[model samples]
Target: MTNENNPIDFGAFTEPKKRPEPVSAPEESKKEKGRGERQEWVSRQPAAEPVAPQKATEGQISIKGPDHIIERFKQLCKDDRRVYYDMLEILMDKFEGK
Candidate 1:
């Protein structure tokens, strides 16, 4: 028989408390908030045209290869086109026995 005077504690099996939602500020337009006066409104200019690559000299010749080879060459160059061109020149010089 349970004692009628003693109360049973059910704290361990209680549900987790829910956190209160954060209150958000009201969104206001820049014009209405007088922010437009404080900030400068600069109009965006048109993008400049891309310059064409310079023509290769009389001694230089352009070679077209497979896309994969070109991509690998670009990767090997590591952001410097001179490295790739220099390597090609050295290879050509060695092959020509110069």
Candidate 2:
């Protein structure tokens, strides 16, 4: 840009170099347009079976106890192929006679 205010030309405050336009691939090479648009052809592979959603637990808790007891609890959970929280939930239900 031509400088009008200052007699000195520092090449600052000038418009940046323009970037070249990106080249787009052929339409046939592009994937299905978008999620919203419906396709004319059916997919060859079978769709995956939908799984049931698990229950959401919003409550958060923190408990401090003896280290030995905690280690024993973790061992028991590993033996039964259960998570610490899942076993805790089961224990809670058993106590409530659910």
Best by TM-score: 2
Per-residue lDDT, model 1, residue 19, is: 100
For residues 1-98, what per-residue lDDT tens digits would candidate 1 score against the true structure?
A: 23567565555466889999997644454445665543456768657877889997656567799999988777767755567668777768999999
Model 2: how far is 91 from its true place, Å? 0.5
Q: What is the alpha-carbon lDDT of model 2 when measured against the actual structure?
A: 0.81
TM-score, cand. 2: 0.41
* Colliding residue pairs in candidate 1: none
- List CA RMSD, all candidates: 12.3, 10.0
Q: Which runs of model 2 end up more than 4 angstroms from their true locations?
A: 1-59
Q: Candidates' TM-scores?
A: 0.28, 0.41
The model with the greatest lDDT is 2
